[model samples]
Target: ALSVLMPKVKVKKNAKSGKKGKDKKPQPKVNTLISKPKAAASLRRKLSGPEDVPVPDDDSGDLDEPAAAKPAKTKLKAAEPPTRLTRGQRKRQQRKENFLRKFELANLIGKQEEAFRTGSLANLADLTAHLEEDKAPATAKGPKRLGRKAQAAQDEREMAQFQGVLGFKAFQADPFGALEQHLKNSIRLQKEKEKTAAGKQKAKLSQLKEAFRSKKRLGTVKNKFAKSRKPKK
Candidate 1:
């Protein structure tokens, strides 16, 4: 009777007013490291939506469409038959046979697994010993790096390939003076052009003087009245 009355009173109060704590919003999650960017609403943000899907030129539902569209399939693959074996395949088959033979000799020491499951304590101990040995992890070793001489030879080959004819010509044309003489000649011609441009101001000033003189009657004065003043009246 007391428990029923207690819940009824609390329900009546909840109906009248909601609790302040209950009304409060949950806290937003805070990232301690990298956070995803809020995507902008358009293509300017560099993000694509599902509707902006890219369509390939040959998007036909057939798998062979791309293969058929490809030009002549110019791959220089050897024309060996699929059933043929390369040298590596032969080596792998030999290795597999050797491994199976070695495994058979090793397993001959132990009887069938069923015998051990229903056998004496000594057999049980031997099985446990075998399992323990199998579980013992082997130490793995990495391949050794190339020696200094090997590395130097590899770098020399690379340089010879990339440097090709340009480097060979440079070395042959001038062992002591690379292409410095040719570079100097180009610089000298550029400086001569600059000097000619500077002298153009003098030529331009002489042209201006000639143009001024050609604009008139000669004497630097309008003295026609002095020459003919009615015979000195």
Candidate 2:
């Protein structure tokens, strides 16, 4: 036999809730551009030189007196004079740091070059690990910064072994300086060659333009003379 489903019972709504509630208007938004009393106090403290910041007076719950009537007093400590480094002294310190950094980089590059010349896999592997340790991230918080030009020179010197045409020997005396000088000479020669080629091209173009102008003038002259010699129509 089929079973019948039970019907759901409905509850009646309360008559009191049927009445409409009073409509309330939304509160106006406060403009932040107009400074509040507390913000004004902070600004006053900032404008007043580095002495102790004045605290704003707090209003008690009792509606007695407004905070603006009496300003809170702050104990001002005497400002200490700033320590400024002299220009010459700053330069000397910077130069000293730079010299130390250059010395360190030179030593590191020398080791890599020696490893390369020795043809020892273990030495090269150790050099690789050492280089990884000396990377930019290692000095993320330090004052040591490797110059881009120096880094580029080091990279070229390392790859010079594969560049037979360059005839660059990484194991030579002062390999870094030698390779850097060689790279500078190469760049200068390349620029000179480019300048010479550009000059030649410009000369050729000027000659072509002059030749065309001459031909055009001759054609115009010939046309004018021919027109002058023409028989009366």
Candidate 3:
């Protein structure tokens, strides 16, 4: 006879395990020593001290006395050497100086000629003063001296005038031409003066002739009247 097999029973597990309940974050192990407030207060009292240290007030007499005025430091400027000029700059400067010198010389010459024409010694005095200035000594505190070429040029200029004649380079270059020009100018001026005088004389003569003619006409009219009054003789 076959025995009937009994069906296996399935038991349901407990949803909450005793181990899980026991494992629960083991109550964060408290540090009893550190957690004692009384102990911490006693330790703090032992470590700390009184903070009231006294500082002495400054008693030096300097604090009471007026500060001596510090002597003002005068900044002495170092004398800088003159800047060296470039070749082109030097050339340009030389040219400018030459032009200025020539212009001044021309002006002086004109003044001298004018003085001569007007018979005045004032320009001569000025020229002498200028010459004196040129001859003045050149010291560090005084005016600078002329260069060799410039001094030579000055000497030549001094020598150029002799007996009321100017032996200038322009005249020396073409004396005949200069003379011819001078002659021409004089002749022109003379002609102009003669022309003016002739015109003035002609005008005077015309005025006199007009006056004489008018007087003669008046006399003739008077004579005619006189004859008419005298009537048939």
Candidate 4:
């Protein structure tokens, strides 16, 4: 009765105003937690649109071009067969190699000695120049075949020169023999000195032993009393 007495109010219902249409399909939910890089790349691809790669036609002029237009490969040369050497040739080569090896050793030894004497590093160029000057003869003569004696004399002269450079006394023709003789003489002298020293030592030992024996034979107390009592006048 109190609601009837109040003013009547109309309430409008909330309804769809647009015309009815077919129901739209719901889209699958995309993961929002995708990596930033992947999302960025996908966004870029979408913006760029589909890539269109050109397909080559088989009948094109490029296919008809000459094969020579491409780079050609270089062929390697075949190895040559080794030449056979005669016994004499082989022997000569061996001798030459041996000479070179000996020359190198001599040079190294000379350098070392020079360094030791000078207390400084020896210059290779200067040493080589000195060696060359020493080797050079006064006259430029043709190669001559030398006899055994002549060769030996030449060797002795060269050795003497080398010794002189090293501040050693010039050695005889047979340096080895002279050195051996010097060693032998020194040994002999040393032995003689030893023998003389031994003889002197033996004499001294014998005299001491004899004196000791005599003293022991003559009683110590009797000898002392005899010495103390003077000879009767």
- Tens-place lDDT per residue, model 4, 84-171, is 9999999999999999999999999997888878977546688889999999987878799999999999999999977774564434
For model 3, residues 1-233, the per-residue Cα lDDT tens digits are: 01111223334444666233433333334444347878756655556655565655776644567988999999999999999999999999999999999999999999778878999766567788999999998766856799999999988877764523455665778888877987999999999999999999999999999999999999999999998899576
Of 1 and 4, which scores higher on lDDT? 4
Clashes of each: 0, 0, 0, 0
TM-score of 4: 0.23
Greater TM-score among 1 and 4 belongs to 4
Question: Tens digit of lDDT per residue, candidate 1, span 68-124?
Answer: 455665778788777888899999999999999989977874555656666746566
lDDT of each: 0.66, 0.74, 0.76, 0.76
Please report the candidate that would top TM-score against the real structure.
Answer: 2
Off by over 4 Å in 2: 1-171
The TM-score values for the models, in the order shown, are 0.22, 0.28, 0.27, 0.23
lDDT for 106 in candidate 3 is: 100
1 or 3, greater by TM-score = 3
Stronger candidate by TM-score (1 vs 2): 2
lDDT of 4: 0.76
